[model samples]
Target: MSTLAPPVRRTLALTKANARLLVRNRTTFLYALVMPLVPMVIVFASGGASDAAGANAVTSVLLMAVLFPVFYNVLSQVVTRRDELVLKRLRTGEVTDREIALSIALPGVAIALAVAVVTVPVSLVAGLPLPSNPAVYLLGALVSSVVFAALAFWTAAWTRNAEAGQMTSVPVMVLAVAGTLVAAVPDRVAQVLEATPGGAMYELVRTGWYGAGGVGDAVEPLVVLAAWGVVAVSLARRSMRWEPRV
Candidate 1:
């Protein structure tokens, strides 16, 4: 008798299904794709000459790209799925909670990566300096994605419904955006902001863009990001509901 596929394969199939839904949904299209492109077009056209300015602009846009898929999209989708009883039904299947969560998260992560890839060439064409250390820049972007994904899951745990998710997601989104924009101000305040998840990500990416020395330099921001992820994952596991909240 034929047997069902392994959990990994099933998760991949679920990812594809989720991705299809993402593409068809008009609201998802607005936030995930169109939103990032709007700022990108403006930045690309305005054009900064200095490397520092260019790096800041490029990183800002990248952060915006990261925000939608990793934070907004993931939170909205997860909460909606739970509200609709999809998560409860999926729990009866062979797929573990981890698999279910990952499958749900896959579309956003994939879109974020795709945006990062395309943004690189476009930024270069727009006259921004290419990251001096391409590998490190990519690493920073990947870490940011993971960190934000965890944050999304954590935030969704408290979010009551799809509409509530929009309100709930704002604080984290504001923190992330504000951190990048304020990263340049010199003082203890900047230092404090640097400790935030968004700030840590901004510093890491900016450092990489400048081709800074050994990875040792990045240890602090990496540690901060990892700490946030740990906390988020713990909270998500404890609080995230499989059934609709009542």
Candidate 2:
């Protein structure tokens, strides 16, 4: 009476499900659209355009704002949804576990990439330059999005309810704000932040823009991120619950 979906078809369906949900949620749509732009607006108004010192901080803030949703918010929701039976339901159908997880993440990547494309023209119009080395920036975005999504999936496994996804992801938000302060605060603080998760994203992006050779400073954080990625993916496989509690 019924047929099974191919793995690729299953993956596409899940990815579509993820994107549609975000589109339908008015609050989420607003947050995704406006949040990333807020930091850049604030930085420019706060005099970030005045000097090189401010440039590092501005770059960090802008990227973090973009990353928060792509990484923390979306990934955390993926985790929570799994616990709530959304992922489990899909499994009873045609999707494999890998397909489900990858699908959950694909929407965020697409949205973030879209935002990057749109933001570029707007940013250049507003005085930001086209990055001389676009590869590193693109690489940084891809890496950060994937890494954080995995972390959120792991975090959601431990989270009790869907609401906790927001609370649990707070550390990420705080760090993002702190990266912005790198413009206003002392050098040591910003440098220290560069060693954290999204912290290195800021560092890597700045290096891409200016070619100042400072991206090396982010190597330590990059290693830490990769290590975290391994742990998160492993945890998701071993501990991820694919069925609702009976």
- For each candidate in turn, give its C-alpha RMSD to the true structure in angstroms: 2.3, 4.0
The residue-by-residue lDDT of candidate 2 on 18-49, one tens digit each, is 88887787777666666766666644453426
Number of clashes in model 1?
0
Hey, what RMSD does candidate 1 come out at? Answer: 2.3
lDDT of 2 at 82: 62
Compute each candidate's TM-score over C-alphas. Answer: 0.92, 0.80
- Highest-lDDT candidate: 1
Clashing pairs in 1: none
Candidate 1, residue 145: CA error in Å? 1.0
Task: Say which candidate scores most in TM-score.
Answer: 1
Give, for candidate 1, the lowest lDDT window spanning 10 residues.
Answer: 46-55
